[model samples]
Target: MVIRLLREQEEETENRGKKGPFFLLIFIIVFLSIFAFVFPFFFGFLYILGFQKVMGCFPCTGQSKKRTESGVNNDIKRKDQKKPTSGSLKVNSNGNLQKEDAAKDDRLSLDARNSNLKDQISENEINGGTKFAFGELVEATDNFSSNCFLGEGGFGKVYKGHLKRLNQVVAIKQLDQNGVQGIREFVVEIVMLSQADHPNLVKLIGYCVEGDQRLLVYEYMPLGSLENHLHDLPPGQKPLDWNTRMRIAAGAAKGLEYLHDKMNPSVIYRDLKCSNILLGEGYHAKLSDFGLAKVGPIGDKTHVSTRVMGTYGYCAPDYAMTGQLTFKSDIYSFGVAFLELITGRKAIVQTKDRGELYLVAWARPMFKDRKNFSRMVDPLLQGQYPSRGLYQALAIAAMCVQEQPTMRPAISDVVMALNYLASQNYDPQTHLAQGPCGSPSRTGAKRDNDKAQIASDGSVRD
Candidate 1:
C-alpha cells in the first residue's frame, strides 16, 4: 500500500510541471498579439502629427506650390512692363522748346493718371498720361448717349463729347470689355501717344480709367476718317477731290516719315490702313492709332523678328512670310495705302474681270505698261489729275511695292517725291495731250519710247 501511494504522487507532480509551461506560453502569445495591433495605431497618430509640422516648415502641399508658381508669374509680368519716364524730351534749341513745353504738359498729365491708377493697378505698372474724371466724360458724352456715338473699332466705340471743364470738343474711345485690345494695348497707346506730338499725328487730349471702365479722349476730328471719305462716305458728301487726295497722301507720308526717321530708334507703324488716317477740318490728315507700333531694329540689325501683325493686303510679303520686319515693311504698307488713294479700290477685291481680283496683283502688270498706267488712276478723278504728277506718283508706288524689300524706296525719299508733287502745278489738257504720232499718249511715253528705241538698236548690232 505505501509503494503505490509514492508512485501516484510522482506522476501528479510531472503532469503539473508540463501544464504550467504550456499555460505560460499561451499567455505570452495573447499579450504579443494585442501589442502588435495597438502599437500600429499609436505609431500612425505620431507620424501624422510629425507630417503636419514638416509641411508647416516646408511648403510642399499642392495649394502652397500653386501659390508659389502664381507669385513668380506675376513677378515676370511686372518686369516686362515698359514704364514711361517722367521726362521723355530734352530742350536743345528753340525748335525743341515747343517739344519741351509739350513734355511739361505730359508730365502733369502723367501725375494725374498715376494718382487715378493707384486704386486699381499698381502705380509702377501703369505708364504716364492724363486721367480724366469718368463722371465728367459721362456728362460730356450725354450719359454715353448713342447720338454722341461716332464710330466703333476693334478697341470699342467712339463718341463725340463736349468737355465742360476744358470747354473742348473731344472724341472719347471707350474700351470694349470683349474686344481684342485689352489693358496692355490701352497702356501702350497712351504711353506712345503721350510721347508723340506732331501736326500730322492725332493728339490725345486725356483719358478716363475707373476699374474696368477705360476710355481715351482725343481731339475731335470734324471731317472724320479718310476711310469714310475714300470708301464709305455718308450721304451728300462729295467724293474726295484729286488735290485733296494728294494732300492727304502727302500729309500721311510726312507722319510716317516722322515715325520712321525723326523718332529716336525709329517706330514701325504696323497698322497703317486708310481707316487709321483721321482727317481734321480743311482736309488735314493725321495718323491715328499707335497701338501696333513697335520700336524698329537698331545697331546694324537688318530686321526685327516679330509675329506678323497688320492689315492683310498691307503686310509686306517677305515680312509676312518670314516674320522678319524692317522699316521697308512699313514702306511696303504705305505703298498699298498710296495705291488705294490712286486706284480708289479696296485692298482685297473680288472682281469679275480676270487677273484683277486683288488690287496689288492687278495693278502690278498695269504699272509696267505706260499706256495702261492711266488705268491704275482712280476713275473718281475723272481724268483731271496731272499726267506728269500721276506718272511721278505711280513710279514711286512701283518702287515701294517691289517684291524685294531692298528695292523699296525709303519713307524719306517717298516724302520728298510727294512734296514735289504737292508743290507742282497740273494742267489736265496739256498733261494728257497725244504726241505727233498719237502713239505716245501719256506724258512720259515719248521719252520712254526714245529710250526703248536706243536699247533695241544697240541689242540688234550685238
Candidate 2:
C-alpha cells in the first residue's frame, strides 16, 4: 500500500503524545485536593477578619469612621504629651490597650483615694468621731436586727444599737461583704479609732460611709470579750476575779501603754488578741481592734518591714520568722494576752495533752519552774492567786514571752509591772489569816522587797 499506509500515520502521532501527560496528571491531583480542602476555610475566614479588626469589633461603617477619627486624634496627641509620672511606666502600642489603660488608671486612682477619705476624716477633727447617716446606721441597727446581734468577727457583725440620733448606747460594726476586712480595713478602723484618746481605748462614736456600706459606731461594750470573761465562761459566768484578772491585766497594760508610750507614730497594735480585749461596765479593759494598726519604725527605723499579720498563737517568733515589725511585735502579742490572763488558756488549743498545743508552747516548760508557778495558775484561780502574786505574775508572763525580741518588756515596763500587779489586792480573808507558815523570814523579806520594786521599776528581764 503507500508505505503500509504511512505506517498507520506514524502510530497515530505517538498515541497523541502519550495521552497529553495523562490528562495533565489528572488536573494536578484535583488541584491539590481542592487546595487542601479550601485552605483551612480560607485561613479561618482571614483569622476572623483580623480578630475583629484588632478588637475594636468593627461595625460602624465608613471604614470604622476613619478608624474612630484616627483614635480621637491619637487621644488628643496623648493629652498633649508629657504625662506618665506617678513613678513612670507608659509603653503602649495596644497590649490590650495597655491593660485597659492600666485598669483605668487604677480605677481613677482608687476613686481619688476613696474621695479623699471623707475629707481626711473632716480635716482630722476626729475626737469623738462623727459622719453618721447611712440612714443613721439603719436606724441604729434595728435593721441589722436578728435581735440586734452583737457578735461575729473577722471584720463584721456586732449590734446592740439604741442611738435614736445620739440618745447613745452604740456598738454597731457591720462591714462583712465577704469579710476579712476591706476598704483598707475600713480606712484603718476610722483612722485608728479617730485619734485614739484612751480610757484604755475603744470609743469611735460614729461612722457609716453609705453606698457599698460600712458602719462602725462603738461605745457599747457592756461586759463582753476579754474573750467573754476569759475563754468560754457562760453557764455560771463569774470566773474573771483574781482582782478582776489583775484589773484586766492592768487595763490591758494601759492599752499597750497608750499604743507604745502615747502614740505620735508609735501605734503598732497590729491586732493583739483575746478577741481584741473590749469588756466594759466595771470589768473595764479596752484596746479594741484598730484593724492591724501599724506605723511604728519612725526615725531610727529599727523594724516595721511588714506583711506578717497576726494571731496564730499570737504571732511573734521574730515577727513570725522575719517580717520584722517590732515594739517587740506588740510584746509578743502581749505575751499571748498575758498568757490568756494567766492560763484560762486558749491561744491555739487542741490538746490530747501531747505537750499541750501552744499557749506559748505550754508556757515554755512552765517558765523553768518556780514549783511550776502554782502549776501555771488560772485553774479558775481556785487557789485564789497571790502565791507572791503568782510568782510576780509568772515573772511578768516570763518577760513577755521572750524568745528574745530584745527580751520583751518596755510597754513602759509593761505599764510598770501591770500597775504593780493591779495594786496588790488579793485578800482571800487576808490570805487565810497568813496561814501557810505566815512570816517565813517576814515572807523572805517581802520577797526581796518585791524583787527590788520590780527590778527598780523597768522590770521584765528574766
Candidate 3:
C-alpha cells in the first residue's frame, strides 16, 4: 500500500514538474514518508548493522539469510526442531569428538602430512630430473621451520622453500594422509595440475607422498593473493586501481575458460574465491588450488552431477542446493568473485539491505535500477572509471551468476565479455598463453554506428 501510494505521488510530481518548489516539496515529503513505511526491512537492517555491534556474528561481511538452501526450517519450526535437546542426541565428549576428528583426519592433517610428500611426487616428477628427497625439502624450508610457512589450509600447510636443483623458490603444499578423501583430493590435484599449463594458472612443480603424508609443489607466487590486497592491507596502502582490478578479474576469467572450452575433457573449478587468486609483481593474476576441481564430459549434456562442496558465498545457488556441476558453475563463482573485486568488499557482508544481506542477492536489485547501479561501483574508484565499463562488466557477471545454471554464460564467453570491459585490447601473443584471458573480449565485438561485423562467437579472429 505504501509503495502504491508512493508510486502514485511520484507520477503526480513528475506530471507537475513545471509547477514549483512548493509542489515538489509536498511530493518529496509524501514520497519519503511512504518509502519509510514501505522499506522498514531495509532501514531496520541498517539500524542493526550500523549501530548494533552486539547483534551476534554477522556471517562474513554482508551475509544474512531468512531461508537456507538446505530446506531446513529457518522460521521457528516445530518445538522439536526449535532448539537442540540433549535427550535427542547424546553429546559424547572424548569418544565422539575423537571419531569426528578422525573422520576429519585428512581434512585436518596438513601439518602431519608434510613429512611424507617427498615419496608421492617422486613418481610424477617432471620427465627427467633428480627425484626430490625429504632431506632436500627439509633443508630448503629451513628444516621445516616456522619462518618458511606461508599459510595453512584444509589440504595441508604451504611453505616457501628453495629448490636446490632449480635454484628458485617454490610453494610446497603438504596434504593430510589420515583420511581417504584427502588422499583422493591429493591424487586428483597431482594428475590434473601436472598436465595443465597456462600463464594465468600457477605451475604445478611436483608432488610428495611418503607413507601417510602428502604434499603438492608449485611455482611460488611472490605477491601473495588478491584477498590480501583487497581486505588485509593497512590504511595507507593503495587499494587495487580499477585497471588492476579488471586485469585480475579478466585474467582469472581466462583461467576458467581454459578449464572449460579450451580443455579436451573439461574440468570444473568448483572453488573460485579471492584467496585462490595469486598475483605476480605487476598484479598479474593466476588461478590456483585445484583440490576441489572436477573433470567433466564434453558435449551436449546440460550438466554433470557431483557433490556440493564450495566456499560459502562463491557457491552458485542452484549448484549448492543440488549437486549438479558444470562449466557454468565455475562461471557463477567467478561472478561472485567479480563482484567482490569490483566492490572492494567480501562476497559475504553485514549491510543495510535485507536482500543485500548476501552480495549476489543484493546486487541483482541494483542491476535493473540504473540509479541504484551507480551505488554498486566500489567507492574507492571515486568516479574515475567509465560507467559503461562498470555496467557491461556487471552485466556479464549478472549473466554468470543467474539462479538458473544453464542460463549462466560459459567461462569462455565470460572472458570475452570481460575483455571488452577491460579496454577492448586484443593481443595474439597473450592468446598463445592458452590461459582464459587470451579469449576475444567481445564474443561478437561489433561496430554499432555504421556497419555489421562477423561475430567471433567462440573463436578469436583478427
lDDT of 2 by residue, 1-462 (tens): 999889988889889988999999999999999999999999999997986677554344334567779867776766745453221245576632222344334221242256455443432333336767777777777788788897988888888888886698888888888988677666767777777788988888867665677777888888778887778786977787687888888898888888877877678887888888898888888988787787788887898887898778888888888898888888878878888898788888886757448787777765664445556667776665566666677678777877888877788877887788889887766553222322222333333223312232224334
- Residue pairs clashing, model 2: 150-159
Ranking by lDDT: 1, 2, 3
Pick the winner on lDDT between candidates 2 and 3.
Answer: 2
Output the number of the TM-score-best candidate.
1
Task: Please provide TM-scores, in order, for all candidate models, with all chains considered together.
Answer: 0.67, 0.35, 0.62
Candidate 3 Cα deviation (angstroms), residue 108: 20
- Runs of candidate 2 exceeding 4 Å displacement: 11-162, 165-167, 171-183, 187-207, 210-215, 221-242, 247-269, 273-279, 284-287, 293-305, 308-317, 324-331, 336-385, 404-425, 432-462
Off by over 4 Å in 3: 1-131, 177-181, 298-300, 350-356, 424-462
Please list the C-alpha lDDT of all candidates, in the order they appear.
Answer: 0.75, 0.72, 0.68
Q: Model 1: residues >4 Å from true position, as ranges?
A: 1-128, 352-356, 427-462
Write candidate 1's Cα lDDT for 1-462 as tens digits.
899989999999989998999999999999999999899999999998987776576434344668768766766655643453344444465633212455244433354354453343333434535578789999999998999999988789999999988899999999898987766567667766877778999999878766568889999999888878877556887887667788888999999999998877588898898889999988999998776787799898989998888888888999999999999998888888888998788878766766336567777867655566566777666666665566667777777788889888789888998888777755545555434332345655443222221111111010
Q: Is candidate 2 or candidate 3 better by TM-score?
A: 3
Scored by lDDT, model 2 comes in at 0.72
Q: Which candidate, 1 or 3, would have the higher TM-score against the true structure?
A: 1
